[model samples]
Target: MQAFLQQLPALIGVVIGALASFAATSAAERSRWRRTQSVRWDERRLTAYAEYASAVKKVISLSVRIAAHRGIHPDIDALPPEEGLPALAAAEEERTVKWETVLLLGTGSTVVAARAWHESAFRLQRIASGREVELSWSEAIDAVSKARRRFYEAAKADIGIALGDVPESYDWQISRLIAADSTPPERNT
Candidate 1:
């Protein structure tokens, strides 16, 4: 009986050690779970941002093509405005659906940037639709460029990406439009 009593302290120490070990393991698991969740949300946000950007670009590209066809852009090779109308309608429809997803998944700043970009795109669309306001290629392209820069900045900030990651010459699409509009299209046999 005396020996058992003497061993009670050892038993209590063992129990306390087991409890501490369990607590430590539980805390580690919780931390790991939180980290996983954070990574998942980050991936989701990136996908959402990228998809929204792509969709917006599609609409802008179609608008550019339509404008070029209407002789609003300097491109001589573009298909006529009538030929691009169906594709433009399709792109607009896709943009509407993708914008809904952006609204659901985007942060506040992202949404704001997206709205600005979309508005800028709509300006080009209005010009393509023959608003008769004499919108110039430079003016339309400039607005889209500014809005796109804002969106890229907002998206990068949201994802913890440094602003420096964006290249200085970022408007590849707009540049392509300008260059295409300036040059005459090759004749097809």
Candidate 2:
């Protein structure tokens, strides 16, 4: 009994030291894992966000030009039955691929907002291209405008790394729109 009691202190000390070492190593490993994933996700999300934004903005510009054209010509004149319709169709198809990638890579809120924006944009583009029918042109335009704003809000709020150092010259009009439309509640959330 005396010898066992004498050895108990050493065994206890060794067990405690082993546990401490394991805890320290585990904590360090966890921190390293988190940092690695943080950088990876940040890079991925930024790339996808930028691509999606570029695609959507291109569509929006075309839509705006079409609407302005309709305004310039008579209501009966309609958009020139030109290649613009075909071009818009191709862009929308490509946009679907981009949106799919964005959804796969983006976070939850970003994914949801992106889907909403893309759906609305898709409907608007279809109408503008005359590939589909729309009851009211104004409604389509308004939907596109809202979707664009929502997309910007979702992208701006993401903590993507490249988002921090994004060049100002890339999309001046887009930045202006985001700034003007994305409220604090919309972004900070």
Task: Estimate the TM-score of every prediction.
Answer: 0.80, 0.65
* lDDT, model 2, position 52: 83
For model 1, name the residue pairs that clash: 75-181
Model 2 per-residue lDDT tens digits across residues 136-172 = 5555555656666666667767763244454444445
Residue 98's lDDT within candidate 1 is: 85
Candidate 1 wrong stretches, greater than 4 Å: 1-5, 132-137, 165-167, 172-189
lDDT of each: 0.80, 0.65
User: Looking at candidate 1, what is the lDDT of residue 76?
Assistant: 51
Top candidate when judged by lDDT against the true structure: 1
Best model number under TM-score: 1
lDDT of 1 by residue, 91-156 (tens): 888888888877887889989999999988888887876765455666777788989999989988
| Residue 12's lDDT in candidate 1 | 97
Show the lowest summed lDDT stretch of 10 residues, model 2.
Answer: 180-189
- True lDDT of residue 189, candidate 1: 16
Model 2 steric clash pairs: none
Worst 10 residues of 1 by lDDT: 180-189
